[model samples]
Target: MKIYPFLKNLSLVYVLALVVSCVGDPIEQPIGKFESGVLIINEGSFGANDGDIHHYDPISGDLQPNVFESANARPFAGLIQQVRVVDGLAYIVANTGKVEIVQAADFRSVGAVNDSKLKIPRDLQVIGQKLFISDYGPYDENWNNTESFVAVVNGLQGGAVHKQIPVPSRPEGMALIGSELWAACASGSQLVVINPATEEVARTVEVSAGSPHFFVQFGANWYVYAMDAERVYFHRINHSAYSISETISIPLANAIYNGNFTMGTNGDVYIITTSGASARVAKVSIETGVVLDAEYFVGSNFYGLGFDSSSNTLYVGDHAGWQGNGQVWKVGPSGSLIDSFQAGRGPSGFLFR
Candidate 1:
């Protein structure tokens, strides 16, 4: 299929074809043409111009590295922070100052958005047809954060920001519960509730005196991870009144606050923490706010954790310093390694198709 690339001064004139190349390495289950696999996002060294994406097939044990450059003939400006794959498109957010949009099915460059409002974009969330980007706005001459806002952009229109909605400083992870959007401010110490209809701050939930960073929604309850305090703040929201019903705090042990986590099928949270040498994954219960498994899964350089509900398999991203390349492990619930494959540097995030 043909896809268009993002250009600054020119229109969408450059077209590229989407291609998939199989690796030479052989393994147990080879992925078919349309089979599901894993996509690993590598946050390359800052300013090193090495950020790239890797694709792995568990059945085939095939690993494809730097699929972005392979498909588009150009590299991402490095420092790739996160990638969100939704609506058949992959949105790659890099500290290099833009969101690169690509066709998810074939990894072809579709378009991009690098508006002035996107200075230091951190995270992204898609609600319906709109895309919300959390930006840590530029700093002043004194090295103080000027202001942080969420740039609202049209997912269908592309190439420009639709509007800038002011929020707390250093906005990070964002969650959408019904019509309300909750954004965590890493530097503001609160969770800012935004009413998308009005594009304004509805209210703020004081998570900590320090900062509330990442967030995940499980059923009717919302969990916000406060790294500065080593606590996970849970809240019950009142949608009608646009307020929080109740808030509970759950403290964690030996939390290093530098990894990614995901929710299991049974509503439990699997959080990863890297220690002096080894890494561990713990399961936190959503109902009781208790640690179900203090050491559910353990490894070295376990940078990312994800749960696949279809096969009940857990995929762990191991960036064990393999010369800028990484490894992905398919582990059982009991922490037993089932399979392992190669990937890119710092495999910090995953997307299963």
Candidate 2:
């Protein structure tokens, strides 16, 4: 495997300048219409904590290392778990128990949405004009803290969290439909539905044959392709009834699972995982029930997955051990590893900036 060279080392002095002003071509200036850029979690606090977001340059496939584009985080945390961008603002969800709002242009702080009321935030999504954030509550696996909650902030209401709701158990990921919210509970193995307008528990839908972990909506159905350490489970959802659509065993003697994914324009779903103790990116054909292919990612672990909708450059977060170095891989549409750039630690969830 040929290791691609980085355009600018993190040690380069003009890297930040290069990030703002393009160095070549018949035309200069970063060539991306916030059409859908990526807000990546590059690094975090020393011990698996909070991270920052970058305006991922996918056309050229590079991580523009910025000095000030971090979450308006409070000094020290483990990792910035998830983030989503809409209307030129990056909504960064920090697992260190904070939600930050940063300007999309220069990546600076604007405001923050935190629930000192409810702690340990996990995933977030923007639907219509509202922001729905999921709280993982407590870390039962690590015995950290295991309660679960959800907060609905009306973006129309000045990003004001108008409602705070509770769920049956801890949430790993979530999906939204208009005014309805659906979250996957790690413990209950149920997708709990909530109506933020009424702050009421509406319904509970079971996902997969086993437990559901992550979800994304494509076309008319919401697809929850999840893993519970041993197997990969796929569920095809059409609003109400969802059944185990497919089940495939991952080829790993000891699989280190990371809960993040990206869906292609053609409805194919991608999950980043190891191919038997080796760093590889696995692709599944959503239309057909098969593990289509796997690409080498050149790292120990991956966090978030981002794809440039137009050019189809795949961006992956390189989280080696939740600390020290974080790198982002740039892979071509055909799963060819091309280049990479150093990112932050414990990077999870990415939004196209």
Candidate 3:
């Protein structure tokens, strides 16, 4: 027989094509696409336990014990206070008056700044190529009579001190809103706007009791989130028109150490109240003081709050030491617990670029 080779092969090819179509999907659900973050908690070595820097995954909800641990990485043999992760470098603030740079990928010590260079650097704020470190100068062990310094350093220079610009008193938290460096004087309720070009204090935005912590600039407004002896104040942004027009309270007394908050794309504000007995993160419409939802971390240690606009994910770190292993949790748009991951000690605060 004249073997009908073409016809015999055609049937087999058609069957194979049908089998391929019945296979699984090519595009998998991006459940874990959201990048995880590191929590660098200063293990207070005094009477407090050594602070732990934890790594948390928003996808898996796992909290690793310690990411960066050691004496050199640990500035004072005390605690690792503040941290700024730029590119892949981790700039950690040591209460003993030094800032150490570690590999963000592995938390290995890359370099460090001495006391003479950085006098008790608190949280870090970056502008262009310069890093504006909140230098709350050291005094007696009782931590009295302190003045704030904004040490502008080269981002690439590991421990090199560029120039230390003096502010009013003990600047703890800082935010680079537009071109102005708003210094949050932790000891005093004052916001000094610094000019990065001249390193001069342009003006001061007066706050209530607590000083400004982490800030977010939204819609021609620089929200100066400050707190005093009793309450946390939200000073609306007015760059070209600088003033504290409207302010709001936390509904609870003393919202201190609340670094966990982020402004949503829709102009909504999300905040976590750790200082209060509530120990929860609440979402609210910034235009109104209405609470839409709140996430109560009753038993967990909570500290810093950050928002990622890309995936619309919210990150929170644990500051309490008793929690042992700290955490970095992922909150959904509705302020729901989506996922979590393991983290290092005290995962104080994190920045997502």
Best by TM-score: 1
Determine which window of 10 residues in candidate 2 has minimal summed lDDT.
247-256
Candidate closest to the true structure, highest lDDT: 1
Pairing residues by index, what is the TM-score of model 3? 0.71
Taking the tens digit of each residue's C-alpha lDDT, what string does model 3 give over 1-353?
77598987998899888888777547664432112453535445445646556555544555454555542345234467777777767777776676767766666677766648666677777677777778777676776746667888775545577787877677877777777888777566677789988877898877754567656676666676765444455777566666667776544443436344667767666666654344776666656655555543333456666677878877766655545555567777666687766555555556553
Flag the better candidate by lDDT, 1 or 2.
Answer: 1
Q: Taking the tens digit of each residue's C-alpha lDDT, what string does model 1 give over 1-353?
A: 65445452234222221111234345586533323687778877654758898877767777888888988888877678888878777888886678898887777888888786788888888887788888888887876665888988886435789788887788888888667888888778778888877778888877533356777777766667665436555555565665656665556655656536787877677877666888888778777878788788787888877787777888888877546777788888776888888767777877778
- Which window of 10 residues has the lowest lDDT sum in candidate 3? 29-38
Query: What number of clashing residue pairs does each candidate have, in the order they appear?
Result: 4, 22, 32
Off by over 4 Å in 3: 1-49, 57-65, 69-78, 103-109, 140-142, 160-162, 208-210, 245-250, 258-260, 274-278, 293-297, 308-314, 319-323, 327-342, 351-353
lDDT for predicted candidate 3 compared with the true structure: 0.64
